[model samples]
Target chain A: MTQSLPSASGTPNPCIELSNVSKSYGLVPALSNLSFAIPEGGRYALLGPNGAGKSTTLKLLIGSLRPDSGRVSILGSPPDSRAAKAEVGYLPEDALPYRMLSVRENLEYIGSLRAVGDLKNRVDYLLDALDLREYERSNVGRLSRGNTQKLAIALAIVHSPKVLLLDEPLNYLDIPTQEKVIAMLESLQGTHLVSTHIMSIAGRLTDSVVMISKGTILWKGAIDELKRMGSPDEPIEKIVARMMTGAI
Target chain B: MLFRVLKFVLRTRFSRPFLGFILLMIFYSIVISRAIPPTGISVIISYYIVGIVAFFLAMSLATGGVMVMKSDRDFLFTLPLSSRDLSIAIFFSQFIAYGVTVLLLFAYLSQAFSSALLLVDLVALALTLTSLGTIAPSMTTKGRVSASVLLALWTSSALLKFPFTPGSAFSGSVVYGTATLVVLAAATVTIAFRNLPHVELDMVKSMVRSSSSEIKAPNSYVGKSPVSAIYFMNLSNMSLAGRFNMAGTARYVSKRVKSTWVAAIASAGAAAYVAFILIAYGAVHFSAAPLPAQIIANVILGFLAFAFSQSAITYERIWLSLTSLPPATYFRNLIAAKVLSLMLILAPFAVADAALAYLGYAGALASMVVVAVVIPGFFVLEVCWAAFTAPIQVKGDDMLMPAQFNLRQMAAAVPLVAVMGIAASASGVLDIALIGGLAIWVVSASLAVSGGFWNSVVSRLTESGFV
Candidate 1:
């Protein structure tokens, strides 16, 4: 029953690390003795079924939730430490910005807090890049869900953080916006860990996958390696499902 | 079928702690009836009752909607029950929802009225409250506001010694007042029942109309540093009326008006209140001091501060705020900004206090200190205390949903109430009020500024699922 995970990446240094981490919400275990790492600049997906602790892992790395046991670090610093927080950008699942603030204000407020240089220019750049210029003055409460998602994405990368942690980043986005976001995320130079249930999203956004089930690692490897587990024509989803359910 | 649905709804919607709160209120009412002399009920108390009822009626009309959860929308609305039966069930649900306020209002006053008359008035008030709340959704916003204003004017007629007004029964016009309320309650309940089935459709219409209306551009915080941005944004963007607890501690973004407007309105209200004090005690009872006015103003300010402070962090997204700066730095600035915003609202009252002092009221100087320095300082402690205890995460929009109250949430409110009690007791004494308020402010400021304290607070907040 010892399922092996390949070494995190070809690169040597880990920008994000979780060592023997275990977490729970009351009696329900989220992650038990879960250990993993993404090398510096590694782009990887934390793939899992619902309740497989994907979000918890991300929360732990972002320092919103502490593990019941073991260690979590970002860039070799404690995740909650200012140094690590400075280096990491995060997008929570179903994220809502300040309802009272306009889109432009939200960006500028957070940008200024993060000490982004020439923040007004940075905010303008983000508005234009994300096609949010038309609605930059719109209150976040009034934006359509897709535009809100776009704003959330813009907020995540507003400071050009060195490590991005995105949970279901494509959620509520249109196909075109998803493509735009994917391209935007790909163009950014940093390590990325995307937590998602969609296999296609994993394949598209990241080269490698860390599959988890019931709060433990089920398998971890490059998506190509995962695909090779089945016949060439097998849908990546079917392959992922089989592995997730222990049918493979 | 109606009975079945009512039973199901109550069982599902009423938490055990809320039931406990109701039971406790009943017990406290019994104690109050035994301890307090009922001789204090007089003509002035009757006018106060009219004001209280009018306030609740306006509130019910302004914020009313059927309490529908996503689950209820999916299942309860789609049920096969007859429309009449379903409507009755929803009406009863709304009654229970509004009954908490009724219970709180009547808990101490139950000894004043005869049991039979008390029962009649209680039933009448509860029925009117629930009926207006239920009927509100079917009316347009303009219609609702106009109706509320007209009704308020009519209600205030009772102050002129009008017969059969809702407050007239309490004002010593027993038979006619009772008759009027009974008829009004019957008519409103019937209308509410008839309108209940159309709530979903009306809600849709109202939402569409609201969304399609022109949205005014909000003020930009464009080149300001983070601290100033937090300060000004919290000041200008937030509304005293917009903050409500029904939706897991979220604020209504649509209700926001400029802080200048809020300040102006508040000043006018403060002036009116001062006028009321001068008219009642100064002009009418020339021998009596305005001690009650001073106490009421201070206590009211404290209560409003507590209410505003609840949303200080409830609407915050940790990923955005905390990750941008260290927790201590972010929250210290956040609390300071909120305190400053509260102080802006307090400025008018502070001016009112000074005016009161200039007019030679004995305790007005003490009241001024409480308003200017004490409450704003208490505001800082209140915000940090809320973050420490009962930091509820606000998810997506659920403005129409009823708040799921629990004992823990009730516990979180107790300390503030206790502080208000202290202020009420010591408001007449300047040295005690000033020293006590400053002591609280110093302790709160020390805790707020400490990096270690914030680290622990952030940990607790995350553990409580504030993310």
Candidate 2:
């Protein structure tokens, strides 16, 4: 994968940033003063257990939900702002596409909305890369969970957005397709924050990891540094579990 | 034991609301009965018999299918009870619910019933309830196709009435009703014992197949053009399109007016041609031409315009998928789209009327003016009513599920219809100019009210987490 310098040092500043953002539903807090930042061209993983605010964080970044306190900015503006949304692409957890639409129709429809350049060619490339060539005419409702995930991923990246927020991007995929998707996502030139529990997915798709628990950040650093914290030959999954549940 | 079963039934979240709603309906019927004369004794008896029969038929159709075909059947069949015991339990539970409803209705309309008739009613209700419970399990199957076939058979049997009328066929009633109830009960018990296990296994297999298949990769396709620019524009307009664009507004208004003009013109042209034929042929005495004919033309034009206005907004439910979009964007586009669509649907008819007037069809021209001037006003009133009172969710089978309606929502629709009717009536006595001026005022007022209504409703729905 090609490497690019962190854009935060430049005059335009970072592509996405969150400073102590907190959100809650009634008595249950979803995100508790969680903070993170991704500069332009940064590839990072957001690792946490279920209900650890992984989905909530992505929703905040995508402007689907507003933070109860603190701040979240995308490309230096509020997440839903035209300029911010224009540069951002998001795939929600268990993302559901328009069920009535066929695969090709969904791609083209979203492409038109985003005003992507050479829409047809871009859609074709994504379709082939994702290996969704045979069920193009099928309604999305009829597609399997794995295929639905593929279509959702395609939709998120259709605009070739500058800031991408993906929740469980490789969910429901077989091992081989997961590998293919990691490579495909790595090839894109943009800032990416992928939320997942799988350490291997984090390691392959991103260089850095941000571990969170109980809606707060537990650790943030390189994947290599996280591995070094564990004893030699210790599985990364155990390490992640320890960090998430605060066992260590 | 009965109370325990009732408690179990009520414990289900769906059942409580359903039962409560039915009770409320029964209460409302009682209130209405006080105002109208009590239906005669014969009619009351007939009503009870029909209600009992319908209740049994409903139970047999709904529960029988669920018992035989559903996965829940396994749990039910495995319970420590004999088939006869289970059938009796099911029968009484359904019977009690139906019986209570009838008792409430009779209490409210007490003046209509005699002691002998009430006894017969009770007997019929008991027989029907038990019969349905017995029959339901036999007719239903695990598969949808089989269930449908069973339903068709049940429906045909219910519709096939006996030769004796309610009061006339005493002997036939006794024989037919008793035979129907006994046969249904026997068939249900037989079927319940035989089909229960096979259906349970089939259900398990189907569930497993569905879940396993959900993880497979879908086949893809290539070489298709993207969706049209217009489709995207419509989607954006419905979902994310910001406050009004001047270009979009002008295009919409022009389109609306052009179509309405076309309709108006077409009506006028047809009317003028008929008038010319009447004049040329001297088919009838001119003095004999009824004045009501002119009024009829005016009413037709008025109704056409009213239809145009109502349909403009109603069409959005199907054409635009507004329900899924962001509320502010959806409302804005809805207002603009309806305004345009109405103009398109009604403007031609108005223009056609004016053209015919120019061609010496005075009556037709007059009707066209009534439509042109009255329609837009009606459109605004209807739109406002719909904006405030029309339920946000589209009517479908799912909507039939329990829902609450507020008093304010129920009242919101009243004024729109009333005001339009009053305005149309007033148009008859007032000078044409005065009526026209009033029409414009009503339309403008309705439009403003509608805009505010949309904003309030949208905000509330969003805040409530309904959308």
Candidate 3:
């Protein structure tokens, strides 16, 4: 129903694209006539209130959910197509990583399934990068919440996914850990679409914001543009709060 | 406030089909009672009613974990509501959900839906609840050891033991059980209030950090090759390690070996006990044996079917893990891992039972073959259908069916069951029947897969919502 970014001026095929997409579970509609496109290698933050379809959007991109109507494409092919799914990585909000599995096992299993090149090196890199080395032998069910989340993030990117969809990725982390995650994400290449209610995380990981309310795009623009619109002194959260509640 | 929570629980947890099943079971119980001549016999009727309810509660608890201990600490712990109020609300919600079902079942069995048997049932349920309360607090902790310890302690308590046996509680001693029940329930309530403020959000979601993990270096076993990282806990089945290239397969085998060892021990014990009875009676002959004996053996084989299939369905966790593997490979590995685990666990017992029994070793060998190969392989197909369609809610305890099933699965299963059930019926000749039955089921299952049913199942699994 709305376009959040400027009209496309470059390549016609964006890395991630959803055209007039809509999906509903039972009587409750999740995404309604949603349309958005992220150019190849774009980094964007998805903002919406709880149940505003941020997770739904990510699921659609990863082929976890088939749109009831409209289309979802990854790298110019259907999201569910083998080629598209192979290139996508997802971190579900709950991040249940086979509770019976140890951290290293989960990493290795997902990495091999992903058929990532040099699978061993990739698992090793993630185990080290995500700070999950210590609990590598412990069952995921035994890990602390922060550790589980780290394992989840690791699993998502274990194959060095071409497109990453992360939802509330910073939830439950200590401040220092949050900083490290942000720094790591900033260094990664490829398209990253982060969904979070935390304004600070949005500001740090992405320069563009795609804001939706009640499952439809409410606004899309540069974060700087959003900050500028709030009169030179207004906090961006205030502007976001108003926009999310339809007070804008 | 408590009622509000109860409403939410009922709305969320009870589905139309689940409620329908409960009603059907109640009606079936009632019809049987009326059809029989037990109306005039109060003792028989009351015992029947009490036994049924107690069995349901125990079975549900053993399988689903202690329902009475359920806590949605997510919202309640953070709310302004007092711990006492929260405790009452949580207790009553579980009470109405499960407790009411017991009452309804008892009432239906007595024909009037309100005979004097209900008071006994209520007392038994209350004792069970309080006993659960005393042990419930400990289950919140993870791992098998803590639970086993608590279960041992609870079983040893006289308060729990008195009422659970069939006729004792309904006799004169129910009052003591009732009083102990009240005291325990009160103590549990006090604990709940004290702990509510201190409770944390169940999600210990410390979203991981980008910082290096606590371990300074990778394990010595791990090298550039991922397979070298293979290791296991004391409970694991490390035997299957060297063969599979799939890391998922390795992970699966390690986890399974823990339960497999336990199953093997239990199966061995049961087999030895049965074998000794057979050796003593001098009736080792299997085929050409009485019909009941064959039925008894096949029932165990049926359990193997239920167990293997239940474990194979991954519920909500396999979506990402299996996303890249080809459909055929995924299904293949899934079946292999599940069947292999069952055979490894049960094969020794199968061999021992067949060898020790007076029945010719050939019959024992044949029965064991059925247990080791036929059931596991066929059940895996049954599992595929169940997981794809209406899979039963897999719990820690065994249900009539491990996962849910729908019309398609039921339709698929009927022929297999009829063929196997009929074939396994022949006295002493069950092994012969089983072999033939296995061939038919395998061929049908293969056709189901080749006919695009397998793909549909896979697609349903990967794209479906949380289990």
| Model 2 lDDT per residue over A65-90, tens place | 67889999887787655566667788
Query: Of models 1 and 2, which has the larger TM-score?
Result: 1
Predicted candidate 3, C-alpha RMSD: 9.0
lDDT digits (tens) for residues B257-276 of candidate 3: 35455666757765764656
Q: Please tell me the TM-score of chain A for candidate 2.
A: 0.92
Residue A17 Cα positional deviation in candidate 2, in Å, after optimal superposition = 1.5
Of the two candidates 1 and 2, the one with more favorable DockQ, higher being better, is 1
Candidate 1 residue pairs in clash (backbone atoms < 3 Å): none
**Which residue ranges in model 3 land beyond 4 Å of their true spot?**
A1-12, A26-28, A117-120, A213-218, A241-248, B1-20, B37-267, B270-274, B283-294, B314-316, B326-328, B349-358, B361-374, B391-464
Best candidate, DockQ:
1
Ranking by DockQ: 1, 2, 3
Cα lDDT of model 1 by residue, B1-467, tens digit: 77888888766666677666667777877687788776556666777787876767666766566655567677777878788877777777777776455655565666555545766776787788788877887888889889888777777777787876776666667688778888989998999888887767422223322532223756665667767777767777564432343211212323456777878888897898689777777754423277778788888888788777776776788879988778888899888877877777788888887887787766777778888877887777777777777666544555323235565655667667666865776567788778877887897898889888887778778777665
Q: First chain TM-score in every candidate?
A: 0.94, 0.92, 0.93
Candidate 2 residue lDDT tens string, B316-401: 32111221233344454545554544454445555654554455543444455455555556556655565445433311112211
